[model samples]
Target: MASHSSSKIAIYGAIGANVAIAISKFVAAFFTGSSAMLSEGIHSLVDSGNGLLILFGVHQAEKPADARYPFGRSKELYFWSLIVAILVFSVGGGMSFYEGVEHLKHPAPITDPTWNYVVLGLSLVFEGISFFLAFREFNKSRGDAGFWATLGRSKDPSVFAILMEDLAALLGLVIALGGVYFGHMLDNPYFDGGASICIGLLLVSVAIFLIYKTKGLLVGQGVEEETLDALEALARQQRGVEQVRRPLTMYLGPQDVVLALDVEFHDHLSAIEVEKTVDELQDTIRANHPEFKRIFIEAKGLSGKQRNPLAPDPTSPQI
Candidate 1:
């Protein structure tokens, strides 16, 4: 819960920064007639909107489970994150690419670049602050894995979406700076358009990556290896349990997981004993993994037909 709260903090910070930067970039772009500058403005504006959507999603995700939705609205976060990816592609990437093509066809000289430089510099600073905040929040839960691995494993989409948007913004600013400088240096306006195209491509790539990542979380994904292991070990500790099958786990949200286990209790155990053992096992599991909102344990033989998530080896890492 604390980590989720931190993600909201990071998101709120990014929203403020992007809104300020977008307004400045639009003013400068209007004055300078720089294609790259316009693209940057659009990028910031899209990011600002995305931040709002994420906040809304986060709120909706927290809605308590009701008759209509038994598992609650936790997946709403994933749905909104997917929309963020779509927005980046359609608004940021599409607009920039279209502007780039138009500018390349009939390039126009940029007016006084002084304002452009000033705005770009300020944007870089704002984006840097936002990026740092996101990275700090993300780094808190990243463990020892590399950044890319952490991104892939992260269940929270709000933090990562902001991180990627800020990352793209920073890189886009650098490209915009180069384009503006060189367009004036060589008396060629097409360089500005080329930079816009590059920024568009960058946004496209970031959007695609976000889509891929969010899809897994939205559809449902397995719990981490350590978490599954702990649950499995807890089940085995129960008396009269001869064997435990691979536990099936699904993430309903970052903090909510549904777990199911197929266990074969010893044939010698009485019905009352089996019931007693089951209750103890559940208590132990809930104590160890508070994330398990629902746990279903069935008494069934391991016929080798039902695949075990922990199969192949008892100690191997889960996917």
Candidate 2:
């Protein structure tokens, strides 16, 4: 719950900054006729819309389970994150690239770059603030983990998505400043168009990276291998258990996981003893890892035999 609140904070900050930046950029682009400034305006507008979409996804994902969806709607966030990536690639990157090509074909000089400079400088400060907030929240979640490693392992997309967008925005601002300065100094409009093209490429690369990260979550990625190994060891330690197969686990949300385990008990254990052992194991697991929202335990006799005739086939894969 705390993490969710923090993520929302970062997202809200980014949305506010982007909205302000977009308006100013559009105004400056209108007056100066700078291709790079126009592209940056579109980028900011798209980013604002993406932030709202992420917030909607987070709200929907928090819905309680219903008969139609027993597992809840936690995966909705992943779906929306995928949509955000597609929007960045198509609306943001595609438009910027197209705009740059058009500008190059019929180049026009900027008579006054004063408005462009003012808007770009203000945008830099706003985007910097947003980036700092996102970085702080993400850093809190990561603890001592390295930045790239934490990003790869993170399940929450709102914070990381904002972080990535702000990074790209900052870089694009720098590129736009250079384009304006150099085009004015050299009396050449090609430099401005080239900067827009470079910003388009940067946005495309960021979108691709976001798509790759969100894909795994949507496809039911499992817990870390070390986590699985620890769970298996814990199951094996329980008395009356002869062997324990590796457990199957999948994250339903950032803090929700579903776990399944197959345990082979001694043939001599009575029905009551087996029941007690299963109950104890479940309690132990819940105490150690509360993130597991659902747990299914399958008990089997030694030598691949079912303890009860009604039990599932022992030869079939349980995990």
Candidate 3:
């Protein structure tokens, strides 16, 4: 995931593009009476609103940890992301399906498709720009991974959320274009209605995926595997650490991680030595993985500890 500032650029760019496109599409839908265009308008409007909602989430998430809510409001982003998914699915997708079915029932003749074409063409350009911006920012966190992998592993939802919205908008525009053109050619408004329904289904799928990811993050996802490995290595490198237990990690936010570790010290280490080793291990881990906002280490060996399945014992005990 990109930093908070970089994510904001993507969000703001999408908001500007979507707002302008929504207005134009609404105007065209009004003048042309095209069901496809109407659905497209709703899609863009919802996208714009979702961008605003993400911005609000960012603001709420940045609030410092307080006495009442000690972990900070970082999960606010996850909560609002869930809200965005629900809105996109229910309002944008459901409304599109409704309008499409209604048009299919009535089969009202589309008055003029010229305005629909114009609006769709402009929308394609603006949405493409937004998508490119989002994709670029998203790629920063992806590294050598494929697009699908990057999307699945993305910690920050705002970037991928905008990416999916823009992609859906572009596809919806194409479907709308085909519906308008073919409806005029074959003189069948059913084609337009069918296209709208297809667009709605597309949006529903995207919303479902977003809902799944956001909900997972809200429920407390963990740090990357590489980071976890690094934590274990750091524990083993400590001066008096005899064995390293499994290092547990969970995210409080996109960039915030809470880590818990249990380490077994040397069999006969003094209390002072144990304390020194614990402090040094913490400092090293923090220096290596700054994402760990809170780190807790427990000396499990002499504290009447139970043998943990996850810990690895060294062949020979050191210091």
The prediction achieving the highest lDDT against the true structure is 2
lDDT of 2 by residue, 1-319 (tens): 6777888998999999999999999999999999999999999999999999999988888888887878888899889999999999999999998988999999999888999999999999999999999999889879888999998888888888889999999999999999999999999999999999999999999999999989988998999888898888888889889998889888877877888888999998987788778777777777788777777788889977766322222322132
lDDT of each: 0.86, 0.88, 0.85
Ranking by lDDT: 2, 1, 3
Error of 1 at 142 (Å): 0.8
Model 1 per-residue lDDT tens digits across residues 1-319: 6767888989999999999999999999998899999999999999999999999999898888887887688889989999999999999999999999999998998868899999999999989999999999989878899999998888888888889999999999999999999998888999999999999999999999999988988787888788778777888888877788789988777777778888887666665676667777766777777777777767643343322222112221122
Give TM per candidate.
Answer: 0.89, 0.92, 0.91
Worst 10 residues of 3 by lDDT: 310-319
Candidate 2 global lDDT: 0.88
Give the RMSD in angstroms, all C-alphas superposed, for model 3: 5.6
Evaluated at residue 315, the lDDT of candidate 2 is 25
Report the candidate with higher TM-score, 1 versus 3: 3
Better of 2 and 3 by lDDT: 2
Tell me, what's the RMSD of every candidate?
Answer: 5.6, 4.2, 5.6
